[model samples]
Target chain A: MKKFISVLMSALIVGTSVFMLSGCGNGEKQQELNVFNWGEYISNGEDGTIDTIREFENRYNVKVNYTNYESNEEMYNLIKESNSSYDVIVPSDYMISKLIKEDMLEKINFDNVPNFANIMEKYKKTDFDPTGEYSVPYDWGVVALVYNKTMVKEKPKSFSVLWDKQYSGNILMFNNSRDAMAIAMRLKGINPTEITKKDIDVASAYLKEQKPLLKKYVMDQVFTEMEGDQAAMAPYYAGDVAVMMSNNENLDYMLPEEGSNWFMDSMCIPKTTQNKELAEKFINFMLEPEIGKANIEYLGYSTPNQKVYDLLDEDVKNNELNYPKEEYLKKCYTFSDLPQDVYDYMQEEFLKVQA
Target chain B: MKSKAPSIPYLIWMLLFTIIPLIMVIYYAFTDKSGNFTIQTFKDSLFYTDVFIRSLWIALVSTLLCLVLAYPLSYVMSRSSRRGQNILTMLIMLPMWMNFILRIYAWVLLLQNDGLIDLAVKFLGLDVPLLGNAGAVILGMVYNYLPFMILPIHAVMLKIDNSLIEASKDLGANKFNVFRKVVFPLSIPGIISGTTMVFVPTASTFLVAQYLGGTGDKMIGDVIENIFQRDKNVGSAISLVLMVIILLFIIVMNKFGDEEVVA
Candidate 1:
């Protein structure tokens, strides 16, 4: 009788151990989807507002593990190196092309995302995704001039202001190659995407000359630098311009007459993602008018969702930075992925300047 | 009598973490396609311009800064009362105990224009651009590694015989002469160890450079990081080249340093 009891007890212990291990394993896999996006670009849905992720969680019964990357290049490298199973990635237009060319992204199925119809008519069928097959537009904005009124005597409207000798040592330009090149290209009245040896040389010369004038080349943190009043002026994303203006009364956002770069950051699934269905659900959840509007309002970017735009507050809808006049739109250019060889050449030249 | 060798499990752990990674790096250094090994990978990275020279310069600067700032503080601590020494040592090491990334972030806040230091400058009516420059990167490197320098020098100083200093003084050596001839000579090992500790890590750390440095402040670590993280290169080749660079640096420094010791 005692031997029988010992065997029974051992069997029960084994059963419990198996049960615990299985429970932990399944729990980890069942409700988890990893999201990689820009930092501070999402709402956490606290303070009685519905965050997009919370909406996804409620409908899909999946927990979202959100992470942020500061730049598209950082995101691309990370996803390439590690077996990163990020279900969703947000990258800009040019980056999407790069990823697609490299076969890094999965061709998204729109059938799973019924809310794609809600996107603005213009945002659809962009050069980056000809068929609109791989990506869903998230937020779109222009990179425009943001300056401190208190520092400048005259209101600056042209990209020429960046090259002004008077503003030397007080001006801040974007440190990124693409953004900086875009500004220079527009000022020279050259096509940003078209690669000519002379065009690049001119841009390089312009940059070298501007180097002395610049306090520093900055990226996302340019806003903080501007807020600190270190830079009298900078070329920054329009959405960030609004945020800076709201906080500091001295700041003003301007749409440069020389044109600016128009960017659309989209959400796409990589081929490496293990959770395709869940990713589609989350993408669709983000497209919901309310969810999209909330993100745009909270993050202070222009929404790509037409439904969301109609729902925006009157002030936001009327903001010139968010919706500039049609003439300004004509001057703006959208960046396309350069030929790999051209990109390599540009990278070498950029390093040369540093060297 | 047979003594059982260390269990196979213990041997396996060391081989898995240390030996295998080293082997993989060496193997990948030679390979191409960002993954499978080839000789081209090694050649490409090796030929990459000024990677070795820039790394050496930065490391040397950081090491010199560590030595200058730490030696006096450590000496002072060694001369203090036991309780005071303990307190001072803790204070010096306190920053080290915090997360490395957090410490860097603090430097960012402190160095940025309109940061704490900048605000102080403004309050005093002075124009200053201490943040986002080469000066800030060097300052940060010294700040982070100062404790490493101090602790080693302090340990060596505490081990020092007090009678030696008394003997020097008895022979009519002044304070400066005593320090140069007696205390300094005795502290060579500590200096070398401290310099090595500070130099190696500061040279490899790109975070401070990325945050505080401007365009001109790009370091060897940043280049390696760009190749691995930005370019999405398999990084095996970069790793291999970096190892070679570091090995050559250490060897050259050791030869020069040993000669200095002998002279």
Candidate 2:
């Protein structure tokens, strides 16, 4: 029996390796375009529905290789390693800035992307890539409080509510350094874009005090925690807030009066990519009003394209989560690139708080 | 002398798959971003005390749970009829035949707040979150590695002499006493092998902790993976520290295990 089990284990390792290696070599050679983006953030032909990549593949005879990363950092590392030549990448505002500064992105030929006109005026230029050089806006959303109306007596109006001891073990916060720091910065009346090392240290201590009260630190799936009543309130992307509220009647979203991180995910070509034209074509196809609208509607995120935004359903257009009022926008700020020293300090503080 | 060394193919395979990769990891652990050799990377990773402690705790708990659950199951299989033994063994090995990733996905489907378990609870009119806790992490680790525990213990049990057990019974020793005095002590080798097998992989596995476990439940595997994938060579250094700790654990376990036998 002992010899048999050892033999079986050895056989499994060998057999699995052989099978994996066999699959490796047969990858078809074609005019291929690779894309890296967030999971569940794009339509993938579920239930026979037409998806974005499927449309691109059918129209341009180019094989599309779509992969996902849980966070922007994960995507950055893959592009940084292996020279895999990802033709298109969707990264948030600050990351787009970092990539450009590192010279890892290709300059966009706006002439090739005629559909750039569809983009809303507000999302056209930003502190990151301010010249509109490398990236095209994909979607925009805010990080806001997703709360259970039934669990809490009063509505959460500020980031301070998440820190309140009354809701001990009932709050969830973002796990990312930027999102976590943004909330603490907003609460203290500090602009997230210009956060200093001292500010991060203060935020770190503030978060550490709040940690015992927090049910957990969450990322993209903050809604799951809120909907299940595991946490009474969590910081979540605005689009997800709408989905959680709709799916669970007990839940609701509030754009904190003190504001939160507002972000735009944009598509950019990596410098290592060989097929630049195919990359530009894919970007343009995504920008088509109908294509853009379908993605926005399917994914529940706000569209950067004005045509797509106009074509959205009445509920989506009116959904406060998708389109907050101007007063709310006044308090919000886009994340900007922090200096290396400040970033290092934030990373250190984040580690301490997590511990 | 009919002695001949193992074939070149076998040695080459081991070198390429295991030895070379291990060396690469160690090499990366020392190198900085500019590809220059540096000890600063090692110095940087020493600060991640949380990741190391959390991973160790999770692996320790999971190993304990596997041991507790596996002992009885292996005992039953060993003592059962041949036909029953074969059938039970097959069933135990069947879940592992599927892809590890697929098994994780199945667990996700079953454990999601809106998933099968939740639906069943709702049908029975109860509300509870069983999917995201220390309990769930244990369940996943056990579910993935129970076969490892069972097979080793069953091997040891199969090799156990029946006469010794019969004599213990004839000496007025109850079943519980017989198990405690004879069966449990004799199965130490199996326990060590199974524990090591279950503990090491469970410690290094990131997917289970990242997906099934909750926020505070984050393990060292997740941290190492986050660092490695994010191009933080410092994370590789942290991993090297973890590897050293695991090596020390094995050495300690072996020393104590031998000491116990001698005593």
Candidate 3:
């Protein structure tokens, strides 16, 4: 009798939930596309800027459902869950490779994306998506040293300066595991993209040595510390450092001589996309030089669009902080997905170093 | 006399949100990503024991600081005139009216080098690095949780009868003995509650150390956050252990208090 009662109750609950959930959408059905990109990555009509999403909605007679993610792991986990369908996502190169390896990304239908021609030849082919089949290059940048010019007194041209005790208690390091470990690996003469557990151990040991010299491990706080002149030096993205430099005249950037992490975030349609054609069309729309120019201008990242670069103001084009020369690019290595064991070992060792 | 139907909606809500999530956590704690039963996650969690101990130690220090600071202030507030008490409480809650992160940011500005507190200390010939250490993290925690300690103790202190202190006085007890024998004994429940209010949240807190402390001050909560992105089974295992230890701490605390004093 008890079992029967419980089963009946559960059945009733399941039925009610199904009915209520089915009643959620009652409005007239309109075509929709869900685009998942990083927060503050697009210009949304604020401060006399073009509203990219609104323009796309107007161009296509379809409502666009745009969302934002903070990290590649977060985007990957969400898309892999299959609970929510996204027509498009902007993920970095390593994550793109991970998605490709797992067969989670759909091969792009370049026929629909005519704007693929606008991408520079340099941006089109190397790395995570060699054939450029699974992803479209959106924006790209490299990591570099941002130091207080007044405090450092010398132009920093290497990652080893972060360990220099002269700047101890005034230096900042990346709080995140990946970026921080990548720095350690580069300093230890190990390639970040091709890492082993032994390599992680070597990097972790180096980080442990540098921990005493660091003022703090920071993310957004890097902006406050550098711009306010509270810290002497730190490692951060070049694009952000450019913004920081614009805010504070005493700040400058050093693209390290040895090499640094070159990162690029690109747009890809997931295998679970409900609107494939719409996603491709949206990708092509973003590639339009005017829209790309507006986005990169507002977002403060390096652009992959060739036409956008030509249309850019002279000073902006000449600014090496945002646009590193090909020689600098030659000395840069892009991160790729690590094996699961190596990745887990790196995470655990990084945590251990902090402890 | 009461209908059980009044609670049915709440019961369903709890079943869906609380109970189901608890079950999922337990299941994840004991299982691998593929749902295979494994103790390896717990073994992996053992690597973070030092961080767990450090978070607990910091929480303990902050809880004690809050108690020492809040108890006397709460006592004064409880003894004040009604309007004065209201004003005092408004002052306490005024900072809370603004966003929580902004208040922490204000503390960062005050404590950072060449900022308010640092300059003030430097003028006095004290040259301590104000931020980027364990002490700074403790200071942030103590500042953030002081109100939690104050409010509950203040509420209970208000209920203490004035006549009890007066009667002790009339019985030839001095102010010190009166407080020691009568007033202090009565506030045990308040102290227990206030400690609970301050201690638990501070132990699990994340952002304070990230903002104020150096690289070495990474807490267990931060480890869980980092690992959760790639490995949830280990994250859940660590969380489970923290939950169990916290549960044990509460049980031990309740055991120390009189039965009627604990809720």
Candidate 4:
């Protein structure tokens, strides 16, 4: 145990110190574009899919320095705290809005990114970026309640099913405060947007009431539990649900008619970009139809680009679980950046529920 | 003066890495997010009393279990021939060589519903839920830290002068009195250190509970980790409190160990 803690500490120290160091080596005349994205977010030539970064590098005669962050907070901290220069980043909608509020994102010059017009109109003027100036939508997904059909005798159509006493010790819920509290807020008929302390108290009450029934407050572990048939039900992202179903034939999913949280991850250049035009060109390259299709298919998420949607495999394009219909999407809500105090209150109250 | 020169590099390393980070933790604990002085961070951490209690309880249980299991085994290993001691030492250390996360995940696979352990329980006509409980979390902590307990006690017992036990016997002490009056007292330092080693980490570490425990089994470490991502002030405050609790625990343990041996 001591060894594990020491290992974790040294690893975190090394990771942060290394991140703070600005490596300015681009070699002889090869312009470097630093692209920071979520891990496993892009296709990298495996299974005959396009190696998007390699293709970009080879085509433009530029070296693409790629790095990955697991969460928006980590990425935000790196950019805020370090001299590490990243030209491009893929942050989710609320995070993009936060960065925009902080004036950390650079506006994309649409002339350099002609393919911006290919993205669906709805994704362009999203709640997170009303003017669509700071970011271009890359992918979108909604929360889905996935269940092992063998364990759940009835098809679960509502979030209320998660609180059922019958499913005690078999239900997995989100471990993160935002998702967990948002879902709880929704179940209480309160809008998940513009959260308040009163709303948090109410949501936390519901979570506390249901804590006994939860197998675990899980993030990635939901995949193992649901696939292994150790859990009867779990609420997870639509993209990951598709991944889980592929692993376990006993699993199926529903969009929950009441409502669910929707998330959109968009690509944007930070305000600190060294080469703005190159960043914009790289973003445009990502929006290319074939590249977008391969990337979206490999990632198992719904693409915001119309050309990519049209180019998708017939079976993938038709999979409603991965791409919920527009009407069901109407009920889906996207989280915008909350007031800091309210956000902190929500986190504290969520911890209290677990406590 | 000679020690100071040899320790210069370590002292500098501690000042830069440990002391600075610790001071920052204190700074965060006493301040608000905007860098204003406040105790609100500590006040908010009060909401996590239940988690703190649970963490301490789990840690205590794990430590006691390690002591109970390790004491007799260490005693036997100390009494064994040198060859036997070597083999036993090797066996205790073998599992620690494997990746920590892998071992925890293996426990998850073995204890979850219809898992190997659960299957055997079912075959015995039992319907007990094996995973997602405090018992599972405690089991994980005990398994991971037992070797720490055994090795320390074993090392101390091996150092006991053979003449002491013989002297106690010569004084008309039987087997039980010789062990009680001689071998055990001499081994108290090892027991104290072993207890410290097992209990401190068990109380603080979070991942074991995450993998093996249910939602209700959350520890202070888990809460600290989750809250740290959002509010570093409150996280630091909670961490400060946990450290104080652990410090108090160690002080108490040392006092008790001294009293036991001195008596």
Candidate 5:
């Protein structure tokens, strides 16, 4: 029995060493780049379309490691906690600002990315990266009120429709703190980016009042609930609402008269990146007209690439929901990183509302 | 004698994964973001007493429900033929083969307002709010944890000597007395293990409440998760408090089990 046990232990050690050695065997000569973006935010050559990553790999002779994240906060936390070196990450405006403030991001060398000029003038040098030094705009969209036309008697024009007692138990609110508080702040005509403690208290009180009327606070589940007609109304990104509207004709989106959030998700290289030049090459590849057009078509989001916008079909270009009038743009607010104290206060207040 | 050699790997694993991570949590719980020692996070966790109380109440209710459902089911399974027992156990484990998140999502589809349950109720000329409430959350918990309660008790029940039960009957004890005096006392260990297994996870779960419960049913797990994304220090502090509470509950339960066994 002791001899058998020794044989078993030797076998286990040999097996584990073999497994470990196999992982290190992939010492390929090709340079590797890691790209992390949002889930379902890219076009991957489904249905005979352009396979963007494969095209990049074949063109540049470099191996690409791609991953996806569900939320910016989740991506931020993972990058902060793990030593894993991600070359390129896509984060929204506020998160990009937070990363920049923490000095966690690397400045882009625009000379390496000559295609940076393909981005439109409007999307350049925004508040998140004031000098446009760290990030390249990937996609931009607005937050709007999505509602069922069949259920409601009139067109809802204001954010107050969410707080209407008649729609109690039929409304869905964003599950995240910043987006939920933004809506409440917008309803109270308070600037979401310039948040103060007093603003947080007032907005949180408003959210508490709105709590009983909510059916559920959700994030990605909004698509299933809204498309199934289980929910009558919710505040969500315009791009997602567009996807839902295509599946369910009864659904429509409205940009509330009280203004809304206009968010820009951008790609930035982290300071921990081991291959900065290759990361720049991948970013430039993403900005190519055909690649950008395919991504926007697949994701149903607005694009900042002028060449990609020109390549869009007339019907897509004319979709008012995708491209709202300039008058509406005046009221839209882009979020900036808040003071740490105010951010903490907002999170505490948001939790109090739920509790 | 070959002693203490086989357990070396297990001890190393425990030190690396479990002990080190726990120590890190304790360290973060006591310190600020700047690495200075402070008790502010622990003090901050005091304000979230409502969430803790709610989590405890929900977990207790779910554990009780699992016990109530599992006891009779396990008894029947143990009494069945061996072939039948195998089939029953397999059927109980079939749902676990699927991903846990997907299983919970299936419940979401069945329990929504216009979902399968609501549609069936409407056919009977009734309306029921089956989803987005405290009851839905408890039902989710019970549905997911019933197997944990059943497996341990069933294993224990299968080991009971049939002659002991016969002796109880021969002594003029009714079925109720047999169960109370013999079967119940014998099953205490199984019940204790099953309770611990079900109660601990339920108390710390955020997913079931998020998907099934309405706006008012946030748990301590959800608060910890939410805080973790914003501030890891406060999140670790809350987790430390939760760990202590669960550990205390387990110790108290073990003491009760020991006293009952001794009696």
Candidate 6:
């Protein structure tokens, strides 16, 4: 009986392995497209909203194997290591540039995706993709200071309020190195994008000085802390501030006068993709007016799709918190991929400040 | 031979999951991004010695706190009847069945400014900053790991012979002396095992520190995590160093346990 059991277990293992291997091969009638995106960044048809993935599958007769990543670095590492599985990935501006530089991303075939024209004129042919060949802009937002109006007597006009000793232990800062350092750089009147070792040292010193004033270095916890009046102020994305403001009446958001990081997350096909055409098709489907509208409505982030912007509610369209004016946009700087040594140096300095 | 045949699968599992991954870590630790053999990774990790020391200090404090809290509680539970012991053990283990992150989040809600504890303190006219400090992180570590310390000691305590305790008493030893000479000595194995279980995880924990600690309270795990995302070589080096440190710690603990046994 034991021998029989052992034989059966071996057969089951072999059978499962064979099944898994076959599953990866193109044996099915419908072609499969693998999509990786940031967590909670998409609309999944909640509350009678349109399920974009389902609509695309129904329209194109292709299946989408969807997954979520928490950060750009994580997604980049996975794609860099083994790019064959994922056809499409959504990464931020800096990560997109890194992938392009590393030759990990494929140039988009505009002929297959005629809907590429739907992207706003401003988002096209930018620094990240100089010729507009590699990526399609998906969503964009700016960083802003979120504060409880009741806590502070005066409006915080500059980033220096984060250093104010009166509000010490009542302020929150970004947990990540890039965003945290960018704020300090802007505060010091240095261009955050074009940073040097000296600039990093200056910023790290500034952050260390501000450390005592900080309540915490936080990420998603910003929502709970800010909304519950646990913190007086925090630097966070404008889109998340909108969500928090909707929940708490006392909460307000402002773009710092010094400048802030304007980030864009874009969808691109990796070089190792087996389903490039299907991936482009999926991208085009996402760019469709109704799909774009549903996504923007759900996400609360600014839409790069002009048609989606036009179709948004009048209140949403006018909400400066969601879509800041051109003047604000002019002052905002998008992050560029730093050299590996500089990146490592910045990380080391950031840790030193924390230490 | 038949029994050895069954061991083949287990050996393969160890090779595939444990040994290979460890080899990969060691390989990456000693190599550069270009896959050339280099010790630069280890040299770079040396720059963050402060973080390593801070992580060790915090973990040491939390482990000590867990031991202090758990020893008394486990003793009381052990002294109870079988049914009472089972109930108490279940009570201790019940909170663990819930998600660890969720439980940490619950603590966040309870400890944040104007939170439950804050509100209670304010009602009595005493205000305190509860969240986002070293205290909060240590509290979180102790709360999470108290059960780990308790369970091993509890298991060992259950096996402790009552006849030994009675004989100590009958030999004209007082209650405290009996506990010191008999109960405490007998429970050394449990204490050692429990210390190892609590200390290792608490030392490596990044989440508790990230969620509860202030900006100044960065741990080695966070640094390792950050480097792993950016450069795997540096991360692997730091991880290898961490592994060696932990191994050294275990060896020291085992030596201490041996000394206690000899005494």
Per-model C-alpha RMSD: 5.8, 10.1, 5.9, 8.4, 7.0, 6.1
User: Taking the tens digit of each residue's C-alpha lDDT, what string does model 5 give over A1-355?
Assistant: 9999999999999999998787678664689999999998888999777888899999988888999999887899889989989999999999999999999999999999998889999887999999899999999889988898887778899889999999999999988788899999988889887778998898899999999999999898999989998888999998999999999999988889978898989989999899999999988988999999998888888999998999999998887678878888788898888887887888888887897
| Regions more than 4 Å wrong, model 5 | A1-29, A74-86, A99-114, A271-278
Native RMSD of candidate 1 (Å): 5.8
Clashing pairs in 2: A169-A213
Pull out the clashing pairs in model 6.
Answer: none
Over 4 Å off, model 6: A1-28, B1-12, B35-40
Clashing pairs in 4: none
Task: Say which prediction, candidate 1 or candidate 5, comes out ahead on DockQ.
Answer: 5
Please give, for residues A103-215, the per-residue lDDT of candidate 4 as tens digits.
99998889999999899977789888888899998898999999999999999889999999998888889988999988898989999977889999999999999998888
Model 6, residue A302: distance off in Å is 1.3
Better of 4 and 6 by lDDT: 4
List the lowest-lDDT window of 10 residues for candidate 1 chain A.
A346-355
Deviation in Å, model 3, residue A307 alpha carbon: 1.3
lDDT of 6 by residue, A11-129 (tens): 99999999888887857568999999999888999998889899989988888899999998778778877635899999999988899899988999989888888899988777888
- Candidate 5 is graded, for docking, as medium
Rank candidates, DockQ, best first: 4, 3, 5, 6, 1, 2
Model 6, B81-197: lDDT tens per residue? 989998998989899999999988888888877788878988899887787788999999999989999999988887888899999899999999988999998899999999999
Question: What tens digits encode model 3's per-residue C-alpha lDDT throughout A58-96?
Answer: 888789998998888778888987589899999999999
List, residue by residue over A1-355, the lDDT tens digit for candidate 1.
9999999999999999999899898776456899999998887776666777767777777788999998887798789989878999999999998888888888788888999999988888888988888899999899888898888879887988988999977888876677787788778778886666667677777777777677767776677777867679999998888889888888888888878888899999998788898898889889998888888887777888999999998988988899887788888899888876576556555544443
**DockQ per model, Cα:** 0.26, 0.17, 0.58, 0.61, 0.55, 0.50
The candidate scoring highest on DockQ is 4
lDDT of each: 0.80, 0.82, 0.89, 0.91, 0.91, 0.89
Model 5 chain B poorest ten-residue lDDT run:
B225-234
Kindly list the interface RMSD, in angstroms, of each predicted candidate in the order they appear: 3.5, 3.2, 1.5, 1.3, 1.1, 1.7
True contacts kept of each: 0.31, 0.19, 0.85, 0.92, 0.81, 0.77
CAPRI quality band, candidate 3: medium
